[model samples]
Target: MAHSTDNVILQGAHGTFAKQLVFRQRFGQSILCKRPKKSNLSPTDAQLSVRARFLAASVYAKSVRANPELLVLLVKGLQ
Candidate 1:
């Protein structure tokens, strides 16, 4: 089983592709949805890195909401 943080990191790296894989592996194929192709929106790599971190943090927050125990452990580790 993957830690919630791992899922968030993967999501940050691959976007919907990582999301689909994580959901399918953890929850099953029923959650998988067809992802539309992205349109061209240019951003520098630095900007993309920032975006990825923001996205991962958002996903991590949601996961923490869903599983408070896991969140507690994560918090404890950070401390």
Candidate 2:
């Protein structure tokens, strides 16, 4: 990681650039660094379990959104 200062282009810059570099702000200073490469390892059993649960929750939320009655009931606290 490298600290950036006095660079007009990098001032207040945050996010990835060209998918090769990352710009972030830390402790009120601008930071610039190379983007980390994705891991090649497979997911662990615990990770798979969490992913499955997340998918189920996402599907449930989508179903609720698709059903107007369910959405209104949820927003009105089942009253």
Candidate 3:
């Protein structure tokens, strides 16, 4: 990791560049670092199950939001 306090173009610049470097602004300073390599590991059975559950919940939430009556009920319950 490297820190940059100068450089006009990179003063407030951020995000990945050239798919190799990562630039971010932190604590009023510019930071530069190498991009991490992608992981090639496969998800375990438990992870897959959790992901399936999350997908099902997301779909249900979207459906509920699409229905105005359900949305009103949800908001009332939140209170």
Candidate 4:
């Protein structure tokens, strides 16, 4: 079976009793095209940079979508 949440997607594995999972954790905040700041920019800028790097790396992976189980774990960890 497959399930969805606010930030994750979970599904069972094929030909196996185990389950598959996807999590959509915000790699970081999105950024707009603007001039750079002398003070190293704001938090949003930093977050956006990190997210971009993460996506760049993940795009090369086989299955880079979010995992539901991992999402659940992340949520739990946050709490």
For residue 30, model 2's alpha carbon misses the true position, in angstroms, by: 1.4
Writing each residue's lDDT as its tens digit, candidate 4 over 1-79 gives 4433442222221131223322222334222222333586557888899999899878744242366666666668779
Ranking by TM-score: 3, 2, 1, 4
Model 1 over residues 1-51: C-alpha lDDT tens digits?
Answer: 324543443443433555434223444222334566667989999999999
lDDT of 2 at 19: 93
Q: How high is the CA lDDT of each candidate model? A: 0.64, 0.90, 0.90, 0.47
Stretches of candidate 3 above 4 Å error? 1-3
Best by TM-score: 3
Error of 4 at 32 (Å): 39
Model 1, runs deviating above 4 Å? 1-42
In the range 42-63, model 2's lDDT, one tens digit per residue, is 9999999999999999999999
Residue 51 error for model 1, in Å? 0.5
Residue-level lDDT of model 3, residues 1-79, one tens digit each, is 5544568998888999999999887888888889989899999999999999999999999999999999999999999
